[model samples]
Target: MINRIHIHLSLLVCTILEIIPMPISFGTYRPDWLLMGLVFWNMFHPQNMNIGIAFLYGLVLDVLLGYTLGMHALAFSLVMYVASIHHLRFKNYSIWQQSGIVGLYTAFHNMVLFWSQHWLNDAFFHLNYFWPIATTMFLWPWCFWLLNRVRRERLRH
Candidate 1:
């Protein structure tokens, strides 16, 4: 449907933004926008947003960034898997609740990425690594509102 495409395009935009360069400090602060999109999609379209799609999106991101094979794919799939499984609750929840859950979800995804970095190269954990969670939580309300607006306006056409 038109609504679905609108959501997908917005998700794509969020992913594209992730790859663009930012200031060094901003790099560390960049919230997990892609994960937020995944949560939104998983809540709205369980049957549509499957593990395979999540894997593919992550793979595309990996290829674009040339990090490695399956790094992003694996992490994204895991988080989205959780989202899809509990989508009923996510969809029915208030925006605040969904945003809170998404904050936790993005936090968990970033945690997995930190571990992935360690696995790729024996990197030590740092508290600074978790700061993006707070950034994501702070931005969640705005993003959810925008996404909801796009869904409303675009789909009504």
Candidate 2:
């Protein structure tokens, strides 16, 4: 059986990491922890980590970070949908290939957030805002590898 408790604990840790404030200069470049967690879990545990769960994660993040309600919910849900639908195919991909796909997913998530923020608040546009796309893409392989090792180890015992 999949370990529900471990899954939740991992998500809690990701959420904590997401909210930890960084310096303004670096904060804008922070990878989306919650997005990565959702992507990883959904990719590996599609049955358990579905869109509803992703929506909840995003909702919690919205409430915590004081973003527009449902903004993250929508973006995360979209990511989950894409990941779950392609989980089988993605599972067979090489690590680098998986990372490239994940990079695209992360960029899509960010684009949705950017557009929504613009629509809601008329937020200023900056090319620098796209930094997380590269950072997330760059970090995906390590995050997936580390999480996969931990997941395998936990499930083995």
Candidate 3:
């Protein structure tokens, strides 16, 4: 169906956006747009984007961005799996609570990615990995609102 295609397209765009590098000054604090999208998809249509898909997406990201082979995939799959388990809870949480959880999730995701990068080559470790978590957390409210609106409108249509 066209609707399904649109959903996939949206997620793909979000993932591509994630691969593009932002300012280095922003450091590890960059927002996890793909992670956010995965969570959004799982929250609304868990059947569409499950753990397997999350892992695949992670692998693709690693290849596209030249990260360690299974690093992003592993973290992404795990985070998505955990998020999927509590999709309903995410929907029910207050904005503050959701933001807090997202912050923690992004932080952990960044740590795993950093570890994987170093595993691939000793040159990948840096102190900046923590920044992405902070930045992603700051962006969580905006991301959740925007994506939630999209999900709601599509459902309405």
lDDT of each: 0.82, 0.87, 0.80
Q: Which stretches of candidate 1 lie over 4 Å from their true place?
A: 1-4
TM-score for every candidate vs. truth?
0.91, 0.94, 0.86
Q: TM-score for model 1?
A: 0.91
> Which predicted model would earn the best lDDT?
2
The positional error of residue 113 in candidate 1, measured at the CA in angstroms, is 1.3
- Extract clashing residue pairs from model 2: none
lDDT by residue for model 3 (123-151), tens: 56666667767777788788888877877
- True lDDT of residue 84, candidate 3: 87
What lDDT tens digits, residue by residue, belong to model 2 across residues 34-70?
7888888887788889999999999999999999899
Better of 1 and 2 by lDDT: 2
lDDT of 1 at 59: 89
Clashing pairs in 1: none
Candidate 2 has its poorest 10 consecutive residues by lDDT at 1-10
